[model samples]
Target: MAVTRTLEADVLRRQDPELADILLGELDRQSTTLQLNAAENFTSPAVLAALGSALANKYAEGYPGARYHGGCEIVDVAERLAVERAKALFGAEHANVQAHSGSSAVLAAYAALLRPGDTVLALGLPYGGHLTHGSPANFSGRWFDFVPYGVDAETGLIDYEQMRLLARTHRPKAIVCGSIAYPRHIDYAAFREAADEVGAYLIADAAHPIGLVAGKAAPNPVPYADVVCATTHKVLRGPRGGMVLCGAELAGQVDRAVFPFTQGGAQMHTIAAKAVAFGEAAAPEFGGYVRQVVANARVLAAALAAEGLAVTTGGTDTHLLTADPAPLGVDGRTARARLAAAGMVLDCCALPHADARGLRLGTAAVTTQGMGEEEMPRIASLMAGVLRDQVEGKQVREKVRELVTAFPPYPG
Candidate 1:
């Protein structure tokens, strides 16, 4: 559907022109640049409309039909649609659509399954794990005993045998299988086997690949994992929210953990938006879009490799690809800024088992904008020029604007 922002603009402009100007500037930025951020996407206008709807006024403090508030009848509809759609999309026995963010979902899931001080096994942050997994600064690391597993130094792949050994040695209460920057398919079965051997609750943090799992482009973790956590944004291209899915046996625990435990009330507007995005993902076309995302990622990785950048794991089987720009004599942070200055947006990320960071690029946002394999080489060339200091930033920015104009992120 075409995006019509006239009403949004008028209302915001009348109420607060200063904030309205910032919003419009962000829209312009998104429209003109190549958004290569791994965890960001262009949510549909329908999703945006739902987020800005009257549903936001409601304060539904409990599950549907069992709310603490009196006037939750309409908000219940939105929450129910979101819950049911999520369950159907992921084939989960139960779904909780109320966690505030991916970190919230992870916290709630951990709370439901493990106790404070209980040992939890996960990938190390430096090896592509999320902060919630084990970083000392995060609540998960502070509250629980977070033991880390890492990718092999040479292969840049998760060492399953090492993980299995750690699982048996530490015998953690929970084992997490997922990543923030790793660029290959996860062996969920292997994780499941390890978790089973250790009698640990297997939690699959599918925040990065939920859409790919939904589109059957990646492995579904539901069957192998005891609980799955994800953000509605990212590859799902929905509102900025989080969800948890699990079997019926753990439904009550998970639900209670989310409400009256981790959080008090659900954001009904965002839940409504999640319903719309879930519907969109369920449609037949989403699968094609997801496949193209992977195709474009592979091409982009190869193109970047051709530019003398080291693509981690050699290439990608999903929407994201990580590369160390160190070979080009540029640090990840500098490369990110240089690319942004040239109208390409990505992030600096730590490579597997390395102290030095690298660039993490993803094709989800560009794929949402209808870019395909044909556009990958051009994007890679532009990014290389910026990072390698081969082409002037202004010239690359102009080329980026030209390409973005042809694509028109949000058609009206």
Candidate 2:
């Protein structure tokens, strides 16, 4: 349990009736539901304990040995552990565990590599790119001159020729690779070559695939890119925080950017939790878990595709797959809401440069609950029934609830 448990109101107000009620409500929800969002996962209970520990009380203002404040001995140890574990997990020359989120990590990387108003080449927002990549409304776009790229019209894959053309034409200072929606494996070697041709830095945002990369199931870009940024919460199964890993040449700049430019005092408790998570990822069983994540995603995608739904990108090679529910005359929002009511959860996400009819589904959360191929068929069947609005959906939801109860996610 966390050392900060005493700080919770429950410990102080044992006589209050509302405390147990709220806890039981949340517990009941997790005890009888499924979570399928691609960018979301269920952290281990121990990870949660670490995240809520007493380390949160610390006021460490800088990196391990160089802090602005005094009494940072424990915080220094935690932060150093987080950095060391992150470096080992990703095979990076250096790691910074201070960024509050993936967006902050991206900002820090850009700040380290490029001046304000410098040009950057990245995928367009409508084409699976994140807001931080260069959305006009975001600081990245507002601060820099962003040249966006898109996938081919016919094939749902990025246009390398177009990217090369953009890099040549724009002379960008950096090229950002990775996406929230694109499904195939990225050609980091091609990106590395393109960046080199333009004398631009290569920044890989592997927030969606860090778990796969850590398990060595997905292609790693640490050796090929100047910097890589990712969230520790998503596939890494840690706290809701971010990390920046880079080559030794850029290490000091990355650290300063993450520390003084993007955030204030770091969350030392989360850093310690991130250390624990990285330790878990380094274990041999983590590779097996990541492989199962991919296998379960493939089975889910194929099952949905067999039912006439449009599985995006032909198929997925990672932990996520996108499916269009429009064939059954339903939109993504409606499908997601109905699925939630049925005790299954998925997020509605617009397809890359397509209409808002597709749903982004992942297996990480459910797979963490010890589910396997057995849940895929039922999940696909329930999705089909929900989209079709058949009476069978009610029956399917009952069975789904039963299965979820059997495998109780996030058990306390």
Candidate 3:
């Protein structure tokens, strides 16, 4: 679908001009800056429309047709559409779209499969593991016995041999395979084999790559993992929510876990928006969008490398990449601040095998803005100039504003 020129700001302003101004202010910020954040993207107006629809009023407390609350008939249809769309999109026998966020979906997966004291193996925090994987402060760590695994010290790749050894040594109840900053495609088949050897359940935390999977730009984990948990947003371009995919045998357990075990009422509005996004992703155009996202990311990673950043794994196969900027005379935290001052918005992530932070960025939002590989080198050059103190902050911000103005996310 074509991007729209206007939003429903008139109605919002009529009701509350104060809050409306805040909304427009955010729009201005987004329009004027570069969105290099890996975990962010622009949702189509159709998805946004569903989020602000009448479905928001509904408080559906359970699955479709089995709600705990009365008057859920209409919302039931919305949830059903979301579930079926997710199932079809991922080729999963069953899907639950009710989890409130990616972490909630992972919690449900653990609830459905493992006991409180069961041991689980996951990527370590320093190696790109999510907080839900095994952070000491998270519920996963407080409840389960989590064994951390690290990547290869030299290659920055998941040490499969080490993972297998850990799996066999610990005999964990579950093994998780995914990362927030690992830029390569995961070998789900290898993970499946490791899980099988130990009779452990394979849980794929595909929150970042699920969007690429939807567009067939990356491998899908649904076929190999016993359970797959992911967010509906990110490059999927849906509402901010979560989903779980599994085979039919685990459908009942997963659904029950998502509802009564982990969360209460489902967000019907977000479900409707996810349904819209899944439909969009199924279209042929979304495939092109995702492919371009990867292509642009590759260009950006290489250009950043040429500009003195130590690109992780040498480069990337997905939409996101992590790079060390020490050679540019700044660390990752300082580089992030400098980039922000130059109108480039991104995140600082953990650097595997190093104590210092690294910059993680992606091309998802820029691809949504219709940028291509041609623009990536320019972005890298500007970023390097800012980090090296070779250009004035005011001048860089002005150039960034000029570039984004030509490709407005919501062009008028």
Candidate 4:
């Protein structure tokens, strides 16, 4: 499972020198920079190997033991392993690992439960929700009537009373409880209670915190919600793939929705990689990794707050922290660029109910690189200096490279 760049480079350089150059350049970029993006992670070499395996050439159009093609005898094992590992890892009655992305998983969940005109209550994009949850431009918004729920402006936390009120008023067919940028833990119990009162199916999108849930650092959403959708690449530290977990009752419906309704042929290679990640996650070492992810996030938030940035909700209970850097007289976009120039990558996010923007920082990727609580304060200080225009980005870049060199991302 060791990554051999020479082997891949030799193959690519023979047919596509330009692409080989670009791929190697990206690997170098990742090795040298601090990847602080909440939605990103460094997948294992075993995963990379699985993604590049011969399974990629197979065209298995259906589920295991029910493939439409004849040459799926071996690929069936990969798919079955992925499904079983996913179910065991999350304690779900069933799991579908065919969805190509987290957005696709959400689409499949909606396809299984709601009609085109059915109403769905979900968190708003500006309030930490993903675009698939119901942005005006997405198919979810175009097909169904999506009612938005948001955090309180004063507390920066979800207002369950308001959510309950909205659910009672709208009578949505489904209610989604999740966030892409929110820092605090989601109240799945509260969401379930509101959904029950409205006779709605509660879907928990655990894309950002599935690893924490697996490691017992966050509450499990599978027991509280009817269906859970997540991407394997975030805190889970797997390849870029999506999964939908549901009860035995809804398993058949969800499977049909994903295979024929939403996506076409499944990526067997990615499924193989997902199985590897799920197995790794089930190990005790992964639990320690996720615990440190949360611990490091808390340290990073405190360090940023000490530098005068407004850490939203005071601090984080998960892998990410949302901070309003407007106090430093810089917009989120500008701050992101400044940080990137300093070799510390992060995303610009919109604050709750405000026209201004903020930063969403995560510790999952850094933790994957062997960074701990002690390293977070230095990272925060570097980011703060660049955002406040106190030090040159080029100067900070040098410090970042020095730190990154000490902990190689993919050490052989």
lDDT string for model 3 (293-396, tens) is: 99999999999999999999999999999999999889999999999999999999999999999999999999999999999999999999999999998899
lDDT of 1 by residue, 50-145 (tens): 998999899899999999999998888888988999999999999999999999999899989988999999998999999999888999889999
lDDT of 4 at 79: 86
- All models: lDDT? 0.92, 0.85, 0.93, 0.92
lDDT ranking of the models: 3, 1, 4, 2
Which residues of candidate 1, in runs, are more than 4 Å off?
Answer: 1-9
Evaluate residue 36 in candidate 4 and report its C-alpha lDDT on the 0 to 100 scale: 94
Clash count for each candidate, listed in order shown: 0, 0, 0, 0
Which of 3 and 4 is ahead in lDDT?
Answer: 3
Q: Could you give candidate 4's per-residue lDDT for residues 218-244 as a string of tens digits?
A: 999999999999999989999998999
lDDT (0-100) at residue 394 of candidate 4?
89
> Over the stretch 303-359, how does candidate 2's per-residue lDDT look in tens digits?
999877888877899998888888878888888888888877887766766767578
- Considering every candidate listed, which one attains the maximal lDDT? 3
Off by over 4 Å in 2: 1-20, 392-396
TM-score computed on alpha carbons, candidate 2: 0.94
Model 4 regions more than 4 Å off: 1-9
